[model samples]
Target chain A: MPYVNIRITREGATAEQKATLIQGVTQLLADVLNKNPETTVVVIDEVDTDNWGIGGKSVTVRRKQGK
Target chain B: MPYVNIRITREGATAEQKATLIQGVTQLLADVLNKNPETTVVVIDEVDTDNWGIGGKSVTVRRKQGK
Candidate 1:
């Protein structure tokens, strides 16, 4: 019952890519930890740049400043 | 990197409870695993019962049936 949440910037990622990501992560955990993929829960959260921060600055601001 | 995610039914948990939960989990990891609370990322997701499932049934349906 390993639960994994993957967070990424809200850039355009196709649904197919998301599906692949879920499968890949599940497989990786299964291979390494021997966790059952059937019970493993995977959630993907796409966060807005304005809401994501780095080094006390929002990603939105950092991108605008070319940092 | 120790990232903890808490998922609960969207049944009106107060801000104080959320704060306590964050602190409690962080402390648990720090005490047991000697993890750094400063770097441990904690995320709480209040999922609607409709979107959460148990025993092959959505929590919404389970609640409706008094399960």
Candidate 2:
């Protein structure tokens, strides 16, 4: 079984979008690696902007700084 | 910076429990990998029983079968 974890900065993704992502990722794994979707696990985690950082700066601050 | 994603079957983990996990994982990465906690990201995803499977059987079914 292959487990897929997707992390995204919380920007209010609708349920439909999340469903699409889960389905697409599952299909990709099945197609590329011959994994069974029935046994695959996909989870999506939405992190708050303040809790997610890049280049030593939180996404919130980076967005404000426009860099 | 290190990103850690933890997946577990949805068994009603308390907020405090999740907080402990986040802190522990972050500290582990910082101590072992020399990662910065401020830039470290930890996300926990609780999967439903029906969506998580092992050996071609969903957790729900396996639980019901007592195997």
True contacts kept of each: 0.00, 0.14
The TM-score leader among the candidates is 2
After best superposition, candidate 1 residue A28: deviation in angstroms? 20
lDDT of 2 by residue, A1-67 (tens): 7987678898887656666676788788888999987778776667899999999999999999987
Screening candidate 1 with a backbone cut-off below 3 angstroms (N, C-alpha, C), the clashing residue pairs are: none
* TM-score of each candidate's B chain against the true B chain: 0.90, 0.91
lDDT of 1 at B2: 76
Best by DockQ: 2
For B1-67, candidate 1 gives per-residue lDDT tens digits of 4777677888887655665666677778888998876666556667899999999999999999998
TM-score of chain A of each: 0.89, 0.93
Stretches of candidate 1 off by over 4 Å are A1-67
Which of the CAPRI classes, incorrect, acceptable, medium or high, describes model 2? Answer: incorrect
- Fraction of true interface contacts that also occur in model 2: 0.14
TM-score, structure 2 vs. true: 0.55
